[model samples]
Target: MAADDLPDEVPADPALSASADPAPSIELLAGPLEIVDRITIASNATFVGRIGETEVVYKPIMGEQPLWDFPDGDLGHREAAAYLVSEAFGWDIVPRTWLRDGPLGVGMVQLWQDVDPAQDAVDIKPVAAVPGEGWRLVFEGYDDRDRPVALVHEDSAELRRMAVFDVVVNNADRKGGHILEMPGGHRHGIDHGLTFHEDHKLRTVLWGWAGEPLLPDELARIEAVRQDLDAALGETLTAYITVTELVALADRCEHLLQSAAFPHPRGRTPATPYPLF
Candidate 1:
């Protein structure tokens, strides 16, 4: 792609945000950024930095680990695009993310969420110890100790919306580590690099509602996306994704509206990611 074909380097102005609230963090991201430390938990090279008084996470395009499955572009663009998709939902599923030039190079910078240490949104428990309520079981399996365990996540509206968001984006990886549990009971989905595939690659742990009908509110939100795919949303997406991908996104939105339910895993049959942390 030519440099002229590239998307705008920054996000839309704060005045035009879906939240309808002004935020200075977006400006800080495009301005001076100072790295404080490297985050060793992620597969790619990640860093925590300060933009004025705001804290953010930075993932440089150069640090992306190339995969045979995702060859079209680097992960940074996907991160920005994911933010755009989440913004379209107006669900606040994703954090404030945008692309900008950093110390190393151009990368994705996102506002950091302060997590509540006592909370565990997604967790594994001994099979017998799994709670009877407040959680939905994904599957039952054995642990490293060969003891029976159950993989479960909170059964809440927040997680359900995130599950729907994952479906629309064709997210290939929605590991336990990517779900951030914030203080006010709001959960934000992170690490969206492996998303928006043209094919069905929705690998996530929040499939407890598989094959179930979407609620009226859920359907309304999806319809809005489907209706706007050919308008502003589609135009903004073209900056990051290909024409093929944009079409696929529209198809996914239509499919969900037609099916009106959470889709079951297709080819692989419950295609879950490896090292399921």
Candidate 2:
């Protein structure tokens, strides 16, 4: 059925809804898949569905549109790889994601995250002047018809952690809308298909911490991921990206570790994404 025909929110399947397991088993996800709703605005065909008791965002490989920068038919695996890196750091920023065979062929399936609509921390707003304390200026520009406008984001610790994650993963498309604000002020980063690009492609909205010194705890987390790369992290990522890309990931960690500061975007392409939100 078309996306418009489906309900805005479909109730989870009866059998799947009963179980309260926080993470769904791989077996269930690879088994029968049922689409509950379609996310139409997504570049690729994306859906919300129940795999056993878990509601997941499924992005089938068949639906992925070819991109000039990324290899074709690899976005799903890239998404899963980003989750692996997030797990390696124990940051809990990226949600539970995996690659599996779905009704529309193999794809990335991630546990659906329910974001609190009340929180506007990640929301980009146009302001006449710099926002006070809690907010961080992202960039300043003029709106259409030549009116001055400034884009600013929240300056929360959770977002800082996410910015670190994006740096490590070389995320090429860290759009503002991709940051999910969960209950209790927790933050989750999603849509990581454009990551691990073997080159510096770290575009994002969380540049508020740029050039700031890395805290001891944050450095420790980076160190942990670097140590694990040769073993668990490396092994898991090989299934998703090229060996060269893996090497680039390690190099990025080292760069961050040595600098001990948030990176200032360099090179030609603009550091921030278009349509900032």
Give the poorly placed runs of model 2, Cα more than 4 Å off: 1-27
Q: Per-residue lDDT for 182-242 in model 2, tens only?
A: 9998899999999999877889988888899999989999999998888866876776788
For model 2, what is the error of residue 92's alpha carbon versus the real structure, in angstroms, after optimal superposition?
0.7
Per-residue lDDT, model 1, residue 1, is 20
Candidate 1 residues 151-241, lDDT tens each?
A: 9999999999999999999999998888999998999999999988888888998888889999999999999988778888788877777
Whole-model lDDT values for every prediction = 0.83, 0.80
What is the TM-score (0 to 1) of candidate 2? 0.88
